[model samples]
Target: MGSVWMYAPEIGYGARQSLVGFTVEAADGVIGHVDRQQDQPGMQHLVVDTGVWKFGRSVLIPAGAVTGIDTEAQKVRVAPSREEIKAAPRFATDSETADPGYLSGVGDYYLSLRS
Candidate 1:
């Protein structure tokens, strides 16, 4: 019970560890479903599963480790992504949590890129 509360509604990624088919919803609408993960040097991009409207080529999401997911709202909100989702810290598939030391340096670089 205690551990469950840690990565849930409150904050941070839940105990669950997997982003294969995790949905990625944006403003206008459910942008697209996560097709694949790319862990680069500064940010992690998600390849969306779009039929024909191939707009987003791996939309950049924060590396805060994908905190909580609102199943009802159908939204995948990350901590660092709020401000600079496109430039949020990058995280590898093994990343369990966001690092504080590297956050400030990012300086919300991707804030303007938000849709």
Candidate 2:
């Protein structure tokens, strides 16, 4: 399996392109928009701001979960469903996001969904 932090090669995402403000869609439907993204090698991920969807909560989605990126439409699609994303480990603070342990837990959760 490929690293969860790296976007799948098939996604064909340009490394220099900014995904911020792009709408994010889950398998079911629209979930939110990309508020921020970490493009650093081995740490790639998107921080989605789910406005009014989950009471303004934010979720951290690893790049590997991204199934597609439509630059023309400014949209990103992930493999998970809305419920699956909502059930993911809560993204609380930047401090936690920086913690190796916390990130591992989050990564493990997403990886498990593949099975």
Candidate 3:
């Protein structure tokens, strides 16, 4: 269990906002819809319900992975592919969401992709 470096905001960023019900689009295609979002700087994340795509499993998407959010279209664009997101650390409950160790794993996973 270890803590990874916090996300560094690139190209600046808007105020932390909710993305619930917003459709998440991967580079290839739509992945799922946002069930919840944590907009805290450095600890931001999205709780996405994969619907029928992954048998309704929910995954945690780090906020840094988000490229853009289109309020008009109600869509959130993510940089990671569907497969990457599918393989990300799962978010089964609120407790897991708050767990530093779990979050560290997620952070490590995403960070590994950039390396």
Please tell me which predicted candidate would have the highest TM-score against the true structure: 2
Which predicted model would earn the best lDDT?
Answer: 2
In candidate 3, which residue pairs get closer than 3 Å at backbone N, Cα or C atoms, i.e. clash? none
Order of candidate numbers by TM-score, starting with the best: 2, 3, 1
lDDT tens per residue, model 3, 31-94 = 9999987766567777888999999899888877777888889898888899998888777897
Query: For residues 50-95, what per-residue lDDT tens digits would candidate 1 score against the true structure?
Result: 4344443334344433455655554565444322334344433334
Q: Which ten residues in a row have the lowest lDDT in candidate 2?
A: 92-101
TM-scores for every predicted model: 0.40, 0.96, 0.85
For model 3, the superposed segments whose C-alpha errors exceed 4 Å read 1-13
lDDT over C-alpha atoms for residue 35 of model 2: 94
Over 45-77, each residue of candidate 2 has an lDDT whose tens digit, in order, gives 999999999999999999999999999999999
lDDT of the candidates, in the order given: 0.43, 0.93, 0.78
